[model samples]
Target: MTSRFMLIFAAISGFIFVALGAFGAHVLSKTMGAVEMGWIQTGLEYQAFHTLAILGLAVAMQRRISIWFY
Candidate 1:
């Protein structure tokens, strides 16, 4: 997979991450219990973090960084 594709994928996932979080906060808050909402928020946090990490790596790759230790 190319770095461009990875970066684009990361960008799209980031948008999705925000949309889902907003949806959960505004829509699910009324229907879901506190515990469920908390879990959803936690999952979103984790997803955001991983996606950002991937984005960073993609940027690094695009810049031709020597990160791969192998």
Candidate 2:
């Protein structure tokens, strides 16, 4: 159940990140300067990477592992 929830959350976050990226590229480009757009792009990239990392961690956590390995 927890794994399912985590997967769903990850999907939602990934979708949001894509939407934000598209918005920044198409809509914000008109109003924002190149430097500002670069920052926004960086932020979106970080967010997307973190979201995927969280998804990976959740999957790892669901697996059985020896305490000594940690």
Best by lDDT: 1
Whole-model lDDT for model 2 versus the true structure? Answer: 0.83
Q: Can you tell me which runs of candidate 1 are displaced by over 4 Å?
A: none
For model 2, the superposed segments whose C-alpha errors exceed 4 Å read 63-70
lDDT at position 9, candidate 2:
86
**What tens-digit string does per-residue lDDT give for candidate 2 at 1-70?**
4767888888999999999998988899999998999999899989989999778866765674333433
How many clashing pairs per prediction, in order? 0, 0
Error in Å for residue 27 of model 1: 0.2
Alpha-carbon error at 60 in model 2, in Å?
Answer: 1.9
C-alpha lDDT score of every prediction, in listed order:
0.91, 0.83
lDDT (10s digit) by residue, model 1, range 7-63: 999999999999999999889999999899989999999989989998988888898
TM-score of each: 0.92, 0.80
**Candidate 1 local distance difference test against the native:** 0.91
